[model samples]
Target: MTRSVYVTSIERGDGRQIVELGVMELLTRRVDRVGVFRPLVHDGPDRLFDLLRSRYRLTQDPATGYGMSYDEASTVQAEEGTDELVSRLVDRFHALARDYEAVLVLGTDYAGSQLPEELALNARLANEFGAAVLPVVGGRGQSAESVHTEARNAHRAYAQLGCEIPALFVNRVTPADREEVRDQLAAHLPVPCYVLPDEPALAAPTVAQIAQALQGTVLLGDDAGLARDALDFVFGGAMLPNLLKALTPGCVVITPGDRADLVVGALAAHSAGNPPIAGVLLTLGERPGKEILALADRLAPGTPVISVAGTSFPTATQLFTLEGRLSAATPRKVETALGLFEQCTATGELLDQISAPRSTRITPMMFQHQLLERARADRRHVVLPEGTEERVLHAAEVLLRRGVCDLSLLGPVDSIRKKAADLGIDLGRARLVDPTTSELRDDFAARYAELRAHKGVTLDLAHDVVADANYFGTLMVEQGLADGMVSGSVHSTAATIRPAFEIIKTATPKAGPGTAAGGEPAAAPIVSSVFFMCLADRVLVYGDCAVNPDPGARQLADIALQSAATAERFGVEPRIALLSYSTGTSGAGADVDKVREATELARARRPDLPIEGPIQYDAAVDPVVAATKLPGSAVAGRATVLIFPDLNTGNNTYKAVQRSAGAFAVGPVLQGLRKPVNDLSRGALVGDIVHTVAITAIQAQEPG
Candidate 1:
């Protein structure tokens, strides 16, 4: 039998799409076969259903997901009474359920339905379908007391209809009242009540929506530019200087077409990436000259420059009234919604309450999600030394928005703020520190001098060194100011970690029961790295690929041990393969001997580790090759961690797999450091930085 949950809202504009998205995410995490169904949907394009299908990779046909249109359903209900409506919906839902392990039933939007009692109708349908109810109540403009009362009343209404209410949510509550409302509702309601703060982006209008409302022409813009939400409206009646100061990120500029100066200035501001505006809207149906339009396109490539027949006043009114919709075209909005849902709700507990079984296989998306969930569990503070970098700031916005971790960005405070404002990103509780002008400069210098005194470093030299952002961030970690650090988006790897070697040094693990009499760890400590090679089906750890050009036998052993530990830390079982050109002594050479010796040393040090030696790349991972080459070796065919004989082989193999095989390589994650500090590739994307920062935060959770 297919299990199902009904996501319904009490009133219109409750913003229940966030709840639906959250539930879909949770269900997909638990089961591979999940379906979506809607009892009655509005006419036109079902944007919400389309988004869910695209995002979750649903296979259910759109025609099968819905029972009937709102008009048809209302007519049926009015003529045949409610019984026929409920019976018809139940049949459609079961058809969807038959092919899925779990069905997520999206309830009515409470719009255009002629049913006398919509809430009662939803409760009846949920009960008939034998699905648990998750109700959402709108609290955007309500007081705390009003929200609490409405929530209690909603629960009562559903319960009065004999519906099984697993949980209730009050979304779009004011931030000031969110916590108190949550506490009061949790205490007052029988079921769990989650309070979600109002997200302005959810209510803002996109440029496309604005253009559609005004019946405007796309003078110059693309589909991507059209999809951006117009968070604010900046009318360009003022001079360039004054208008620039008023510009906010995602704001749309509305001006007369004759104001070519304003158009050029706005595009230039966007091109500089200060605060990227949504697009430019030209009023009075007037277009700029040919040269001006060409210059504008070159200034901000692909930015929308819409021309409306309506004047400024009417256009502004229509734009304000036009709200953003949850659609397949607006994926960034989907991310924002998911982030808010995860931040406000007790996702793990809610999933447990929903009783969705956890998945066994870890996909790339799952790995990234788990990294974030773990980091948020016991939140840590991370400092980004490349604060001025655009990618870093973008990642910071995502991190802060999702409540991933507390951030302390190191750069010029004024410059960072201006840049963020120009980009229209919200730092949201992130602390900014100017490394050169911070009051802690002297104290940091003194500490650095003390730590490096044996190197004959004077106070003056220490002061100058500490002024560097990387050195300052490293010292912050050493002095226990931040949990970890992530840099190297622009700086070299050596410049990023050199200070750590001098000050933090390598950590010494505690001796285990099989250690020497002096309580020293069995293996000599060494710093190594691994890339979590995220394939389509599973994640494998490729070690020493980015560090240690050519490690010897003992160093290789240490790298294997560290890689095994790192693999286990990130939730991958370690079946290690010591790789070389030969397989199980089939060939003899210096390379094979080195791998053989390293395997022996690793086994001698950690007898419990599962390891194999002198394995080729094919034999290490391919079961067919393993069956022929090394009959029944445990690690030959299914190694999760591959230890390379030298950097030349490891680097080339990882790059080949990453590029040719289309796998995501998520590291060069530094291991065996005194504190958790990771580096990013110079060409890393925003999502890459976000993942690296999450990895660093998770590492900070462990003992260095």
Candidate 2:
């Protein structure tokens, strides 16, 4: 079983970064902890390592991730010999490998290094680390014959070194020659060879690079604008009309500081969306007047305007010399690179060839990934009531980008668009509905009044009440116009769920031993909720956290059953613990008695479930305590679903874990409702909203 992969290049500039990213993304999807190691690193921060660290939330210390710097390696090799250097690096590599399920070993770069025989060194390290090597060859300036030769030679070099070469890649091939090269290499090579076409966007320098290289001051811009790639540079020595003609899409315009006329003209063109430029560079430390600056602000709200002291000649030289590198600071480019790699390569075949070990533990990130993937598999429509809120809009943008579900945002349509524009969020493909004046308003009101007629809800009163966003969204779900609804980002939990209770109500009673015979049928399951408490290594389900305040034994048992079913629905095995202040008759109290009764009732109701009674929090989660207090109990310590005695304990425990232990509480995901309607906390971030919406989509998939 291979535990690591080595991504090396035949030489520098092979564009192996794309392959590295694709591998990391693949590993993360299958495993929780993916470690990164570079056998040799240059002094200072490694851009590629930093990208992997931040993007994947790697916990490995940077000092331990590398063996030695180029200078240190060279010095050690000269003083101690090559064998000693290899041995030392091997020790460092294993140190990181032991901590993770799998490690990705980035091979030494051929650029800016004092180390000798780099290819031999990489192969030796891969051999010692017991790694599979995937070598990359650059084809930017090569023909089909040259590319084929290099690919074969690179594979042979690694194979001769006794390193496992499962597959190979030929990167940066010209678009026209991509297919021919792929065919030729596929025929001759003994292993799979992936050919990637040249991507100009990945090679373009961003505005942030211009600011750093020229040592300029940022006159106006945000982080988003700074990350935009400056594809081409246009010097502003020409007249306004000539400059307008010269402006190309995503180009940076350089002009004298006093060229306010040129500045306004360029910004106006960008505002009109006519070949929008990346940014404007003001030379000679010049700035526009207050009025012109204000106009510039309105014309291009987020475009970068940098002021540099150098003349245009020196600036242009620096800009032309700049080359793009992958980093955490530029996330858009990372997405583009990953998308390109996935599209051009046979990822499934490559992964099978490498055969990375499957991980058992599910990290918080892994849980979130599963949620989104599940939601997208069979997408359902989800409506958001707080569409005008900034966080809601942001989550909607992410949901659309991930293709999680169909979204219908309920609010004033014009206001929602304006809010999204102000936040620079693209609500692409998300439908906007103004509840007050929608074409379905009268139809929805009629339906609502009919549903509540026995409760004295007249048509006039139902019409006015249905205008509220929460009620309107609930109506959409009830009418099957939308599959589910998520709200309460700004509204209270009661305000968000009250409409659901009135319209959707509890699901029609499930059949089984619990059902009645002739007319009325069985009692409906208790309407409860659960918060998916995502810890560092696993996810635990906490029941009745936000909905029920206090319940008797039967209600508590129903909550447990609902929680266990919910747990199984979301991929968690349901070993249930009825939490209390006492464990196994060690203490006596009303709380303990309630938990004890609840556990017995739950077991009677569902004999298939694993249940424990009156278990303390520590005993429920800690194996050592479980062994001491409740010996031989199935769910004493390994419980994944914990049913609290009351809301006070469940809510407080979840909040403490979320704030102190840094767990991500993805719910109060309301269960037992006829239709799926989940509530968000008033302080939920964009990520929390995204996860909740995904969970709701999954819930909507269950048979009602």
Candidate 3:
């Protein structure tokens, strides 16, 4: 079966942009079998129509067809000589309606604009045909009041003409007016209203909605119903004033005024008519300050405020686990909270069951203080590089003032702090350093001048090199100041890697230019990956994820070595599973041959690797199946580190298991680099950025 939507512009308005986006968002969720039919699409290059066609392409099965008979030719051609264009309009819409499940009739212009009669005719035809008529309103320089009034009147006209419960979509609304319009629309109209967020990104559940879907409770107030849509957290002491200013009509939890200051800032933000915050949550054992009380009295008036006496972190933890909004009875709320906590625990247990194969073979008792000695001696030093990104830098500042790690930042001092302030990134305990601000500026200048002096790098340029924070930070790892360095925020892959290759190429060659696998191999570092699949206390290791695209015989051996090395660092015993197309090499091909060679290589590289390979995907992991397939293969059934042959197989396989099997992947976490140099996709999200930062820091640890 094919699903198609026919969009008609009532007048020559720009509602099509939103008409297209909303439809696409709906399609991603609701429709699977999709096709498109544009009834009477106007001719001569209609960009809006063209853009709609582009969006439709992404939602449908990539291999379907699209028809544009309606839009390409005016309705006049379909029903000529009756009402001139009106006859054809009804005929075309009716024709498309018969073909598609739901036809979205988009009202383009107002009744007053060109062809108001034609607009009315189209609306009536839409009613007669039983289509979903959505008023998509847009104005380049028009007033919001006028556009809104126009939309409302259109809805009234459609209803009076015997249309079904119709909806109005306010298009290209100024972000500031969106909430207000929604508020106003709710009271006057008698229909379901869905506000499209002000973003072009493909729609998914809202973050708030996502939280709600997780079946969690809102924490700020006692009345869980109020916290469903959390605006922000309010710090205790200084929050009252700011709470009044910035509370975003959701739940606000306050702690000390230090925390209160955040609340005040949030409340002051709401204006003569901004979205008012939901409520206030007073946390910890602190009383509200005078300023806070005054502000709260005036700003909130009778808004409900909940008080809980617990530490801020604990308070947040409770709030997060509550499974958003509890307007229900107390007993019901308690059950929901307990259930959610248990669910989280169960997710944690799943993680604990996955262990590294043979990782417990060697356990050391003594601890070393110096990272240099630890890294070289232990072969696994967990390092955490102090970061300069907004969240990290703030955390770094906290750590520095508080003394957290041997820190390194990637830019000039003044610039870093300025950017940090602009972004409101907390410095936490981080010690800020300008690689360019060190005492060895001249020494760096002299050295860099000698190395790349001919690359147009004058003595002055050399000074800049010594002064460059990222360059200096990478140098720390190269010169053994830190065991490893993870950095890429202020630099590129090329810039981050060049310094390391120049200063610390490798103690020995990696298995090869790429990855090492196979039965034949001398001991060497090979490509591997480590993913910290975190489930509360269940932090398991998954490898060959970050490095080694596809393995040949030799590369597989290297993957084992690297995988084993990473597992040891994270304290998980290594259990290797060499996955294959067919178990026991029942199939013959270059792939099986590669897996066989790789298994042979692993036995040689890490003699106690506890590895099993040339095994089918099921036999390699399922104990019940493994017991039958390879009777005595130790790693067959309980493999944690799944080694794949190539990226086409590994990348797709991991993602599927992650989504289908309810698993999470942490990193291809770039492993086997001379120094830590990871690449971020052009459009990585903030969470991705956070994980990468942690990985880099852990890599900086000395071998011990």
lDDT of each: 0.86, 0.86, 0.48
Q: Could you give candidate 3's per-residue lDDT for residues 1-704 as a string of tens digits? A: 22333234445444344454435333322332233433334335544334445534324321122223343223343445325554545565555545444444443333332233555655655555555555554533446566566556756876676755435555545556666666666677776333333321111111233233434333222222232344345444443554454344333444443365555444443322234444445555555566776685554333334455566677667555432322222222222222222221221221122110122122211110111123322232212232445544543433332122345555555556444433323343344566655675677677777767667778887787666555565556555666555555444655655565555554454342223345333435543555645422234455555445666677676666676666666555667777788887577889888888888777765665687778877887678998988888888877666777776677677666656765544554656666664443223334444445445555655232
Give lDDT for model 3. Answer: 0.48
The alpha-carbon lDDT assigned to residue 569 of candidate 3 equals: 66
Clashing pairs in 2: 516-522
TM-score of every candidate: 0.87, 0.83, 0.42
lDDT of 2: 0.86
By TM-score, the better pick of 1 and 2 is: 1
Query: Which of the two candidates, 2 or 3, achieves a greater lDDT against the reference?
Result: 2
Clash counts for all predictions: 5, 1, 106
